[model samples]
Each structure stands twice: as structure tokens, then as C-alpha cells.
Target: MRILIAPDKFKGTLTARQAGEAMAAGVREVFPDAAIEIVPVADGGEGTLEAALATGGEERTETVQGPLGEGVEARWVLTGKTAVIETAEASGLRYVRPRVQSALSAHSYGSGQLIKAALDAGAQEIICGVGGSAMTDAGSGALRALGLRVMNNDGARARLGGAALSTALRIDDSGLDPRLKDVQIRIAADVTNPLYGPDGAAQVFGAQKGADAAARSILDDGLRHWAELLHKTNGTDVQIPGAGAAGGFPASFLAFTTATLESGFDLVAELVQLEKALDGVDLLITGEGSMDEQSRFGKAPLAAADRANARRIGTVLAVGRSTLNLEDVTGHGVKALAAAVDCAPSVDEAIAEADRYLQQATVVALRNLDEG
Candidate 1:
């Protein structure tokens, strides 16, 4: 049997690579002579940089500002002149448990610092994976770090963060880093929310970052004003789909530079050459930390299964858990389903020793597939 084990991160427990390794071990147990190929996948979130590095790249680490201006060690990858960066490495929600007020103050300056570092390393193309952010500044903080000045009506520099963005009167890009003028920025994100509205950035995702109803209102209004400022400064429309990702992190890049948004799963899949990896594979196993109806829309695992279906290869899913039963996924080319939560004694135990539970679940899923 030829098996390809490709799984996304098991969120908060195992990384995509770790999950693949565990699944690979289970495959070895069930099909002792099976030819196993592991191609870890990511949907352009926490593990995006790791996925990029796995394919081929020179890893670089730099001390950059955190979401709340604290220093943090962030890592990125350079493949030729193209640099790959994940916003989570610098200004992710993992750095702080923000309250409504703190969420207003969180900024993405660290992400910009990473971009500067990439530029310093002779990068001309940047793949910015935007997600897991802890801010709602419309990427102004990042642009500020790149020398774009936000000013108040009184001709003074505006304060940083989302709350301050509400007072932004004008933008000064004269001092902005000229190097960015020649850079091509590709934002990898799975979201499709606009910059600001009921279905937009703050209103849709604010609560997850600690914004209350009132605070969400403030953040959404600020995003609206910031979008106007960007449109006035440049003829750029920052309210495009996926602009709301990572707290509107793509807005600044879209306004100030040549930036485009692409599907996170597609970008990562291409980066890892997932198509070539699926060639001639009999079974393609893919999954993530969770599975549900939402997983059908651009999530890595389903996307992988879709690819497998195209090649007439059978696919199985090994997830941390799932809201859907076996019947719910059979139509999506999933031949078998294995959830760690079902195999382990408890959900907590499954997460605590995710590698073990994942391995055991993969074995069962494979055995079940063989029988079917």
C-alpha cells in the first residue's frame, strides 16, 4: 500500500509535521510494508512558516515586538528572494489574554519588523500568512513600523492601536521604507470578511480577541475610518475579501504596496507541492484539529481530500475530534474517519498526549479503510 499522510496542525497540541509523524508511525504499524510519504499541510495560520521551511528555505529568527509592544523572538523563512512569514510569530493572540481595552491596544508592529528584517535580507517577494492576530489596528501598526506615519488633526503623530485609529486624520508615507515599493506581498488567508461592517473584521472576530459589544463597535468604526484614510492616501481598496483577516492586517499592505490575497490552503499546498505528492498514492490521509461543516470551505484537510478525489485515490481523516459522523464525510472522499477524542479515555487526555492518541486513531482508521 502507498499512503500519503498529510495533516494540518492539531491546534494547541501537535503541529502539522508532528501530526504527520504520528500518523506515519501508525501507518507503519497497520501496513508494515506500506510506502508512506508525509507532506504536512497548513492553512496559512500558526504552522505556515514551518510548512514553508519544511518544503525548502533558510530559517531566520529575529527579536521583534509582540502584540503589546513586548519583545519576542519571531522566526521566518527565506527561499531564494522570497520570504515567508506568519503574523502569529510576532503579534499572535498567544502572547496575551486581552481584555476589551487591551484588545484595542494590541498592534501588529512586530509583524512589520519581521517584514523589515526580510527586506534587509534582500527579499523582493514576501508571502505573509495572516491569522492568529491579537489586534484590530487595520495593520496601521505594521505600516507605522515601516515608516508610514499616522497623524491626528492637530498635525501631531497619532497614538498606536485600534482605538487611536479612530482619530487618524491623515497618513504620511513620504518617510515610508522605499524598499517596499518594489516588493510583492502575497497575503495567505482563509477568511473572506471585508474590512469593516456587520460581517467584517471587528464585528465578526472581535469577541475572540477580547472585544466586548461596545469595544467591537469602537474597533469596527476605527476600521471604517482607517479604510477611508487608506483609500484617500492611495487609490487602493482595502475592503476586499480577506482584508479582515488577522485584524485587517492585509489592509495596510494593500494600500501602501503591491499586495494580493490568496487562499491559505491553496498557497500552502502549492508551497509543499501537494499535487505531486498525491501522484500514484493509493491512500491520501489528511485532517486537522477539528472537523465540521465549516471544514468544507477551504480548510486544508478537505482541500486535500478533494485533490485525492480528483486522482481517484481513497482518503481518510484523522482529527482531534469532529462534530460530524462518518456519514457526514463519506461524500467528501473520506473513506474512513478516526478521531482522537473517540479513541482516548477523555478529551483532555487526547490533547495532553495527542501524539499517542493520534497514532492509535490513525491505525484504526487505516484498518477500517482496509476492511471497507
Candidate 2:
């Protein structure tokens, strides 16, 4: 039997590669003679850079400012004329501890610095993966770093960060780097929220940035204003689908750069030629940190499973946890589902024992694979 293993990162526990290895080990215990293929997947969020870099790319490192003005070293991945920039590398929430989560004060200037560096390096196309962001600045700081000035009514340049966005009155784009005009910018994003509304950026993502009720309202208002200005300056609408991604980074990029939004997993799958790997596979195993309703909406595992199902291949999902309704996934063609914590002392313990649980689960699952 040929088995394909493809899984996303298990959040705080294991990376997709590690999970695939563990799952492969379990399958080997059940069927020692079976052929297995492991393909690690990412959802264009936190692990995007790692996934892209794994496919062999030229990596460049630079020192840039962090979300809260701290200096930090970050890296970008380049493959031929295409440059990959992960926003999380510069302004990710991981840089801020729980106690220091401050959406109002956080900025995406460092991400802009990386973009400038990529453009300066003569990249013909740039892929900006927006995920794990810590700010709600609507990409204002990023634009500033790229030489677009945001000024208040008094004509002074606006300060960096989301809080200063409420005071922005005029946007000056005269100083935008000339090279950026010729570059194609693609935004790899997973979310589909618009720029402003109930499902907008601040309402859907601000709480994670440490925005309380008042802050949420403030950020929402600021984003609305930013969107209005962008709509006026650029002829394109800023309230399109996925405009709220990366705290409205997509909207900003759509307005300023030659940008288009695409599903991150789909992009990765095409890049890695996952469909080609599905040929002749008897059973396919895929997973993520959690399996839920959202998983159906272009998550990495779903993408892999879909490709495998197209070939009439059986697919099983082994996840850290399964919050999805079984019926919901049944119609979509997943053959089996398994969760890592079979019998754990506690949630913490379950997380700590994820690899062992996955291995054991895979062994048991394969035993019943042909039975059911």
C-alpha cells in the first residue's frame, strides 16, 4: 500500500514536518512493507516562510525594527525573480509577550523595510504572506517605510503605529520607491474578511492584538478612515474580500501596489506540485493543529485531501484536536479522522505527548484502514 502523509504545523506542539515523521513512524508500525511519502504543509501564516524556504530558495537576512520599535534580525526567501516576504517575520505577535500585547503601539514598519530590500534586490515579483501580525495599523507604517508619508492636518508626518492612524489626514505618495511600480505584489492570505464591518479587520482580529472594547472601536474607526483615504487616492475599492487580512495590509497593498490576493495553501500546493505527488497513492493522511469548520476553507490539509480525493484516493486526517462535526467532513470525502490525545491526564499533558499519541494513533488507524 502507498500512503501519503501531509500535515500542517500542530501549533505549539509540533511542526508539520515533525508531525508527518511521527505519523509515518506509526504507519510503519502497522504496515512495515507499505510505501510512504511525507509532505509538510503550511497555511500561509506563521509557518509560511519555513515552508517556502524548505523548497530550496536563496535566503537574505536583514536587521529591521520589530512591532514595538525593537531592533531585530529577519530573513526573506528569494527564488529566481520571485521574492517571498512573510509579514510575521518582522511584525509578528510572537515578538511580544502576552503581557506586552499592544495593538495600538505595534507597527508594521519592519515589514516595509523588508519589502524595500526585496525591491532593491531587483525582484520582479514579490509574494507577501500576511499572518501572525501584531499590529492594526492598516499598513500605514509599512507605507511610511516605503517612502509614502502619512501626515496630520498640521502637515507634520504622522507617528508610527495604529494609535497615530486616527490623526492621519493626508497621505503623500510622491516619495514611493520607483522600483515598486514595476513589481508584481501578490498577497497570500487565508482570511476573507472585508476592510470594515462586523466581519472587518478590527472586529475579527483586534482582540488578539490586545484590543479591549474601547480599543477595538478605536481601531475599527481608524481602519475605516484609512480605507476611505485609500479608496479616494487609488481608484480601487478597499472593502473587497480579504481586505481585512493582516490587519488591513491587503487593502493597503491593493491600493498602493500592483497586488492581488490568493489562497496561501493553494499557492503552496501548486508550488510544491502536490497533485503530481498524489498519483498512485493508495491512502493519504493529512492534518493540522485543529480540525474545524474553518479547515474546509482552503487550509493546508483540506487542500491536500481535495487533490488526493480527485484521484479517488482514500484520505485520513490526524490532527492535534478535532472540533469539526463529523458529518461536515464526510460529504467532503475524508475517509477517516484521528486525534492525538487518546487518553491524556490533562490538556497540557496531551499537548506534551502529541508526538507519541500521533504515532500510536496512526498505527491503530492503519490497522482498521482496510477493515472499514
Per-prediction TM-score: 0.98, 0.94
Instruction: Give residue 313's error in model 1 in angstroms.
Output: 1.3
lDDT of 1 by residue, 135-227 (tens): 999889998999999999889999888888989999999988999989988899998999999989899989999999999999999999999
Worst 10 residues of 1 by lDDT: 324-333
TM-score of 2: 0.94
Considering only N, C-alpha and C atoms within 3 Å, which residue pairs clash in candidate 2? Answer: none
The local lDDT score (0 to 100) that residue 243 gets in candidate 2 is 83
Backbone clash pairs for candidate 1 read none
Give the distance in Å from residue 316's predicted Cα in candidate 2 to where it truly belongs.
1.0
Q: Output candidate 1 Cα RMSD.
A: 1.1
Could you give the C-alpha RMSD of every candidate to the true structure, in order shown? 1.1, 1.9
